[model samples]
Target chain A: MKKHNFNSGPSILPQEVLQQASEAVLDFNGIGLSILEIGHRTSWFVEVINEARALVKELMQLGEDYDVLFLQGGATTQFMQVPLNLLDKDAAAAYCVNGIWGDKAVKEAKIFGNVNVVSSTKDKNHSYIQKDFSVPSDNVYLHYTSNNTVEGTQWHTTPNTNLPLIADMSSDIFSRPVDFSKHSLIYAGAQKNAGAAGVTIVVVKKDILGKTNRNISPIMDYRKHIEADALLNTPPVFAVYVSILTLRWIKKEGGLVEMEKRAKERADLLYSTLDSLPVFAPIVAKKDRSLMNATFTTHNKELENLFLEECKQQGMIGVKGHRSVGGLRVSMYNAMPISSVQALVDLMIDFNRRNG
Target chain B: MKKHNFNSGPSILPQEVLQQASEAVLDFNGIGLSILEIGHRTSWFVEVINEARALVKELMQLGEDYDVLFLQGGATTQFMQVPLNLLDKDAAAAYCVNGIWGDKAVKEAKIFGNVNVVSSTKDKNHSYIQKDFSVPSDNVYLHYTSNNTVEGTQWHTTPNTNLPLIADMSSDIFSRPVDFSKHSLIYAGAQKNAGAAGVTIVVVKKDILGKTNRNISPIMDYRKHIEADALLNTPPVFAVYVSILTLRWIKKEGGLVEMEKRAKERADLLYSTLDSLPVFAPIVAKKDRSLMNATFTTHNKELENLFLEECKQQGMIGVKGHRSVGGLRVSMYNAMPISSVQALVDLMIDFNRRNG
Candidate 1:
């Protein structure tokens, strides 16, 4: 069966990336050994880590002032680590609660220090990004989620804040070019658009570290990982290797500019199809819609089930919406082809014509 | 050139496991979608998680009293999490500092609450496990590493202590059958005998959770992950999948009992070869040699270099000693074939004959 994957993440990856990753798992870089078997300290493995770090810096256009680290535990770990390393015991941190991920970040930060929720759209069930938020000058840093996977909302513009800005770009990283200098720290779990799960990429402005009074563990401290070159402990070797391959794929596919163009096109096609269909309506405000995860709903439950069933039959996988807000969600990450979106659109049209 | 992987970890896996993993990465279970692209929340993925968890329980003969979780951030994260989740603010934890890893666990525990070093081999450069360790009666738990990877030492018997027991079995997990009921919690990074890097398998007694007075973030809270069945966040999806395949490999190759027998045979072969060679001397105390990693050294730097060069020429890799303790380390994990061990022995004998 011809398959089209629309998983939010661990979503689709380029075929070339998959092929190269497979070869490396068997024998990395013609070293005649599985990537999983190599020592993290070995020149070969170190080069892999170095290249992956370099690629992140190059792709993001992060300056030398920024430290790139590939750490483990996912973005959730970062949620705690950010405060553990940055938030002083007596200080407070500002968070903009845009969606589920944002809420998680706020909850985690609160464990370390006082958290000020600058803005929130939870009353409306996070249907749109809340704007006109005021940043607390007393807080050490401002935190926000770049794109909400569950609510399908994105910050179309950067927040105006003087406090060191920290962004969780797990779902939307590398989808487009952003001013890397604006944020003091940016973290993204690799499962979404970068590569696979297990590795968390953190880009940190070196100045933001060492200011907090908390006694941070080496693994939790971004400065520690940066100093050790992300080899503070044994890293997630294969995950980082695939992330490097994925980054290489991104570079070959024309970097952020081309990625942004394709991402916009894919989301537009799917959203346009949703708009044309009476059976479906997008959940997020159009102006605040996520280019990565396109969420929609049908008023009739029976019709929604039918659409899902038909899509599955056509080998369209992972289109089912999150249980928190049930309907349908098509996550069009960088690797998801436009042809797949077209197939999904055709299925929706055919299903609507037959069952509407 | 044929490569022999002796990396302490992200170590060698069975070639068959690698082949199967590679196939899945390209097209998982004939689903026409890369395993890398599958949604973690899907029923299919849930089945994998469930089966992996079930397999761990079955292998360890763990009952409903235990909760098995596949977590991220390796055992390093657990160093802090174990204390944060179980140690009350007023309680102190007892730690037997056997080696580098055990020392690290103690350091991480101190971040959360009072930590008492009940005993340590650090005075002697951690060349042996301290068997006469005393645990404070008031301590929350007694933490130890089952085997010291760098020092090539293994605890032949569990410590008798009144407190709850926690073991970091990163280097020795699944090498032999263990009494799972003996400890309150057992955590191992999957890179050793389990599978690859990125995931940590944690088996905890359910009753130990929610007792700490400190606020535990979702990522650090074992209870949160256990309640969510280890799907609290997007796990290292591919790493977990590989671990499942490894468990299957273990089962097919005769469970832990057979694994123990094979591991002993390999270790004995390598150690005996070292003993017979006057040019090389085993590093660890003879009474406490590790069945997973065998460490040895030659006083003659020139001869040691020649030996290592010859081993590499004969397809032995990752034998270089740890920087902290310079010597040769031959890690013979469960996936290593007896033939490979025999091959290394042959090389060692040949080198000794020429050098001695």
Candidate 2:
């Protein structure tokens, strides 16, 4: 039976990408050396990394003004690195804490400098986006998460800010098109939409660096990373290779425009099923609901357990909700086929029919 | 023809390990989801990571007093983190600079607190280890590299120190038995002896943490990593999984004792060949020579180029010396077979017969 996967990050990847990545692991480009053993500085790997970086620029429609870096330590590290490189001792950065990830980012940023919480939906347990907030003019940069993987709320529009904008697009980077011109830095942990678990992709405008009064550690320094072209040290080679194959797949599937279309179709189909059933209630507000991760719950515990067990028996996996937000979450990343969403919708319908 | 891989780090891995890792990438342990798509928090991955950590302790003969962590950002991150977590503003740390890596550790350590270079081999261009050094009693910790990858040198004996001992064993962790009781911490980049490029293995005494007065960043703090069991964030899941497989393979192949015997055999064979060939000269002193990487040179550039071209034609790879060294380096890490060293020796013999 074909399994329908909904794992949050380190989620579903396209079947073809998985096949190609496995093959590369065995014998990359017929070099007789497993990709696992090849040096990061080898010519073949250098090409693979460059192509991956180029694809990020092409898909985002960003020009040469932006620099792309493949780094280690995921989005969690970026929570500290962004503030380390950009914030001065006396200056402050603006952050909108709409969900768990945004709050975590704010916490990390405070260790470096003062952080202004411009907006927050914590009062409602992050069930909605706080959109009517001001971006402070005194801030050095405005940092926000484009989508909250836990709460299933997304920013429909970026904050209007004159200060340099930094966004952690960890969960929804290539799922839709965005105006890249407004952001000074955009970083995503590749496990969600891009590729694997090891590397983080950062798209940064080089001009915004070198302004911090604090001495940034060399490894965490954005200016040093930009100058070295992201090869200042041995990178995560196999992960970067996997991300490259994923970028190639993204290009073949008609880029972000097509991605947005499929995303809407999947989210609409699943959301409509929930709306039709009284047992299920969507967690986030309609305007702020995410197209990537769909969160919902049946307030009755016994019914929810039964629904989850039935879905599990029918080859559906990873539908259990985060413990903080107990219910259910179905993550439909870019590589998640629409057929999987259809399978999930069918399972939900069947469950509702037997218990409605 | 089967190629002999000798790239220094990210060098070679066992054939069966490669096959199993590739298969897991497709379908992990009969789970319908590919390993690439499995969440880090899933039960299967939890088992993989836990077993990997346990194996490190088992192989090192460490007890409950130590904490084993698999982290991201490689050993480069540890250079600063060791100082960040252990050093206070008033105290100084001691470092023995033997080669490029040890020097790098010292440089990063200086960023956090005062560093005392008790001894250095820089005057000899790192061709030998500086053994005559006194450990400063007041120092926070003593830092050194176990094996110098670029210079082809390894310390036969660790520095005698009453202070806490820290080692960058990036090239020689599993290749031999170590006095684990002597060191406060040991860290290795996985690309060399362990497995892949994305993850790092860290073993530290739990008592040494929480002593630093400086407020270390959560991601860079050892105490936080230990508390969270190295899942402080989404770890390098794929890299950690790969390391688990490699560790399993090491156990199957008779563990460290077998590794040491094979390492000695391969290094002795290659070094003997260099000794016999009038055209070649070994770079490092005999006592300090590395079993992992063997560095040598020919005075005539033309002869060196021809020998490399011949090796390439015969399916021998990664023998080119680092550009800074300007000669030849044959890295024989734990995974490199004795047969590969024999083949290299045979080629050198044939080349000398013709060119002499």
Candidate 3:
């Protein structure tokens, strides 16, 4: 049975990516050793990391002003490292608390320095994005999550601000195109759209670093990682290789322009189906709905369970919503084909016909 | 060609482990979703992490008194995190600088608290281990590297200390049996004997945590990781899965006792061959020579290059020494069969005949 993977992430990746990755695991680039066995410093791996870095730059249309780093500890680690490098005790950073991830970031930033919550959607359980919020001109930087994985909301437009911008694009990176020049730093855990689960991609404008008065640990410092070309220590070699393959796939499939086209189409199919069904309703406002994660809920618990059970029977996996926000979420990342969304729409339509 | 891998991690893994890991990447445990695409929070991955943790306990004969954490950052991250969680401003930690790794740890530890270098081999360029050094009874914990990957040294015996002991076992973990009770914490990057790059295995004695006066970052805090069952946030799922497969392979091959037997046999064969040859000289003292990484060199640079060229032509990989130590290093971790060592010995003998 073919499983339609809607896992929020370490989620769905392209079939070709998985195939190449598996083959590499056995014999990477015909090196005779598994990609798992090769040293990170080896020329083969150097090519991999370098190409992956280059692809990120190519996809984002990033100039030489930006530096790419593949670091460990995921976006969670970045939550702390970001402020540690940018915020000192005397400096205040502005945060847009639109979802759980943003809220968590705000909490971590407060430990490093003063964090001003310039905007928050906590009042409505993060069901919408803040379009009317103000960014403090005096703040060191403004931090925001470009897409909320759990709540299914995305910032379609980069927040216009004079201060530096730091965005966590964890769940939606590579799903669409972006104006790379607006942000000082953009980080994404590769488990989502980029590749596998071990590596995190951090793209920072090189000039934004080294200004902090706080003593950042060498491993935690962005400047140190950038200076070392992300090989300050032994990196996640295999993960980086897989990410390189993923970046290649993104480029091969006509880059972010095609990804954006597919994302919009997939989201349109699912969202339109849900909006049409009397039994189901979209979670976020239509204007703020995430193209990456299409979330919806049914008022009837029994009907919801039946629909989920039907989804499972039909080989639709991970459609169940995050426990925090409970009905269903279909994560349509960059690799999620329109066919998978069509299968879910078919399932939803069939279920609604019987239960409506 | 069936290449002989001698890379000092991310190094060779068992053939069966590689085959199994590769299969899992495509379809894990017959689940429709590729392992690369599955969510970390799913039952499949949860089981993998749990079993990997269990294998660590079973192999080490560790009781429930210890907690196992599969983290993201490599040993370098642990260098600072170890002290951040264990040390405070007023406290001091004792260190035994054996090699490059120990020097790095010392530098990182000094950032969090005062470090007392109770023993150092820098006096002799870390070519030997310290036998006469004493652990400071006043320090919070005594830290040391179990095996020096770059310098090719290992501590055959643990330093007896009244205070807590923390070890960075990056290169030698699982190469032999260990007395699990002797240490407060043990960390190893999984690129060596365990599996692949990305995941770090941290076994911390439960009683040793939450004693520090400093505020540990949430991601850096072992206590937080422990409470969350090492899933404090999204773990390196693919890396952890591969680690699980490697752990299973270790157990299937009769665990640590067989691994120790293989390690000793391979090291003895390679070291004996180099030691007997007039063209080659072992780098570290025989007493401190690492079973995992066997370092050797010749007085003549041309002869060394000729030997390396022959080795490479004969399908021996990763024999090149670390740049800091210009020579040859054959890292014979547990997965390296004695046959691989025999192949290297044969090549060295052939090279010596033509050059000697």
Write model 3 residue lDDT over B1-356, tens digit each, in one string.
Answer: 66999889898898998998899888988877788888888888888889889989898899989999999889999998999999988899999999999999999998898999999999888999996777667789999999999999999998888899999998888878889789999999999999889989999999989888776678788999889888889999888888888888888898889899988888888889998988889999989999999888886898878888888888999888999878888898878888988988998887877787
Question: Which one wins by lDDT: 1 or 2?
Answer: 2
Model 3 misplaced regions, further than 4 Å? none
Q: How do the predictions measure up, each by TM-score?
A: 0.98, 0.99, 0.99
What lDDT tens digits, residue by residue, belong to model 2 across residues A1-356?
55888889888888898998898778988989889999888898889888988999999888888999999999989998999898887889999898888988988888888999999999998998887778768889999999999999998897788889999999999999999778999999999999999999999998898887886678878778778877878899999988998889888999999999999999999999989888899999999999999899996999989988988898888898986788999999998888888888887787778888
Candidate 3 chain A, run of 10 with poorest lDDT? A130-139
Evaluate all candidate structures by whole-model CA lDDT and list the values in order: 0.88, 0.89, 0.89
Per-prediction TM-score of chain B?
Answer: 0.98, 0.98, 0.98
Per-residue accuracy of model 1 over A102-208 as CA lDDT, tens digit each: 98898888888889999999998898988787876888999999999988999889888889999999999999998878999999999989999889999999998
Displacement of residue B301 (Cα, Å) in model 1 is 2.0
Docking class of 1: medium
Chain A, model 1: TM: 0.98
Instruction: Assess candidate 3 and give its lDDT.
Output: 0.89
